[model samples]
Target chain A: MKPSSPLGARFRTAVLTLSLAVVATLGSVSRADVPVREEPQRPSAFGATEDAPLPTVAPGDLQGLLRNCDAERERAVAAQKLCEQDKTGVDFLGAAYAALWIILMAFFALVAIRQRRLSAELATLRERLARLGER
Target chain B: MSASSPDADLQPARPGVTWMPYVVAAALLVALFLVFFVAPRERTMGEVQRIFYFHVASAFAALIGWVGCAVASLAYLFLSARQGMEVIAKITDRLAHALGEIGVLFGTIVLITGPLWAKPVWKTYWTWEPRLVLMMLTQFLFIGYLVLRAYAKKDVAGRKLAAGIAVIGGPAVYLIHVAVELWGGNHPQVVSGQGGGLQHPDMQLTFAVAIASVLLFAASLVHLRMRHHAFTDELEDAYLELSDREDARS
Candidate 1:
């Protein structure tokens, strides 16, 4: 049989293409499987605009307005803190993933090295035995 | 013990090409992609929750591998008792050793990843959590098994001793599984009990993929390790035969 027959080459190309297509489909399917969580609506910080005209304040309304301003400031501070915590959490997650990959790869490399060394030793021993038999 | 013995040239040669490793690597890569890209970031724990996919999967693999080792060891002991040092018993012994070593490898990953995941979510690197302590003990037991096998005399006595230890330590896996429930720790039981575990479809899919990937990878490693051990045994037999023949000539 020819090593690189055109029929075999074509079959390999077709299989490769089919596999890529299947993988792409699986990726899309997984992405679509993500459940949409119903998050509670919050006021956006970016929604506050400088161009919006301020309403004329009466003497009684001025106190309520000042309280509202203080409340908004507190919410903004809380949001900032939450964002910082999320960032820190992401950083820790990244570090954990890095550590996992490094450890797994290191273990695999060690096993491969041991396997290679054993193979070489076995070969040498076999050669020695064969020479003894010849003698 | 002679060059002309029937068993002298009877050892099977290793295959020239093996595709299992490539399959395992590809599965792992797909699982990784699904974990990081497809799975949604958790609401409460944020990105840190993603670690659960691989962490839990590794733990499952390690636990299963150790249990497999124990079962194989028990089978070896049983066979040896009945058949008296047969080829099948030796094969089972080699299998037990391979599984034990693979268990240790994955168990080490679990120990490291567990701490890494814990530090971010639990706010501490190490906790004396019930499950954590039990897992550590189980890993230590298997590590001791591997150490004993490595340093012990290469004879039937050593094999029996190692097999005995494995049989004794096999129950630790069950204890580790229930430790959290019994002691009431923070470890979440996702796959068992009422309202257990993942709510999202993507999370479940990713976890399933991860578990399958690790299991297949562990199986491949065990297969390869067993082949190597078989080769080692064949070499030892050859050496013994050569030595015996030399003694006769001298």
Candidate 2:
């Protein structure tokens, strides 16, 4: 192509426009392929400067976080205490009922043993008396 | 068979009502069911309140035993001096002794169950409360009667003295019942007919069944003891007669 020809100049201009369009499309596709990361919003308690992120906790915020942690711990402890109380009540109830049954069974056993022994002794005495009568 | 014959005067009487044990067992099983499942958990005492059914039931059974003992004792004392009433008086004495022993057994159960219930509810096993003290005293009295009867000589005077002790202890049941009313105590008087009855029908039903079961059980035990006593007496008399005949022959 001639350096100053009108047709050559027109063809060069079209080629430059096509190259720019291809570059723009590739750039957009590459941008879409890469995931975008979103930064979390800082609380109002922190300073307003976005570039210089606060690296240390503020005094007031530290105390508030500690208080919240303490509250969570106390709630858990209270729940545990209630559970222990319920378990204790159940245990005592079982003990009381078991004691009653044991006492009753013991008494019944004593009576049964005594009655059996008495019957056996009576049988022996009757047998001996019958032999004596026969003699 | 002459009245003088050892078997004629001392034969054990057969029980007329034999179905009591079956009824008692059925009632007790129902009572256990109602107490554990049907009754509501108490507001403050929780599961410990279930003990109240049997505790009160045993107390009532003890009262029945003591009262029966007292009546039999009075009868024996009244009839022992009459002519040709020796056999009946002896029978009454045996009944009185049997009732006293069973009364002591029920009383022991009441004492044990009460302390067990109290421990969880009151945070202490025992305290010097009026109702508790009176109940303990009543228990001691019956225990004393049993000990005396066991150790005393087998004679009319000894029997009379033990019978007197029983008559005195019988009135203690009334005293124990009124002890809570007369003097304030921690014991709850739910079924006193005055006020503060059980709110739930299930609790009331369980209470009723427990009482019926304990009372019937006490009666059954008393009958067993009476029969045993009669047989023992008959055997002793037969041995004595046999010995006498051998002595005469020798």
CAPRI verdict on model 2?
A: incorrect
The TM-scores of all predictions, comma-separated, are: 0.75, 0.73
Model 2: runs farther than 4 Å from truth? A1-86, B1-18
Minimal lDDT window, size 10, model 1 chain B: B6-15
lDDT of candidate 1 over A26-65, digit per residue (tens):
5875666443323322111111111223345677797868
Q: State chain A's TM-score for model 1.
A: 0.42
Deviation of model 2 at B180, angstroms:
1.3
Candidate 2, residues A18-84: lDDT per residue as tens digits? Answer: 4576577557656664333233211111111112222454677977677667766765675565455
- What's model 2's lDDT at B123? 65
The sequence of per-residue lDDT tens digits that candidate 1 reaches over residues B1-250 is: 2457524554443533388878988999999999889887665555667788888888888988899899999999999988556878989999999999888888888888777766655666665567877887777778767766764435676678778888877898988888866886667667664564677778888989999999998888788788878877776777677677768766
Q: Write the per-residue lDDT of candidate 2 for residues B178-237, one digit (tens) a residue.
A: 887788677776667765577666677777888878787788889878887776666666
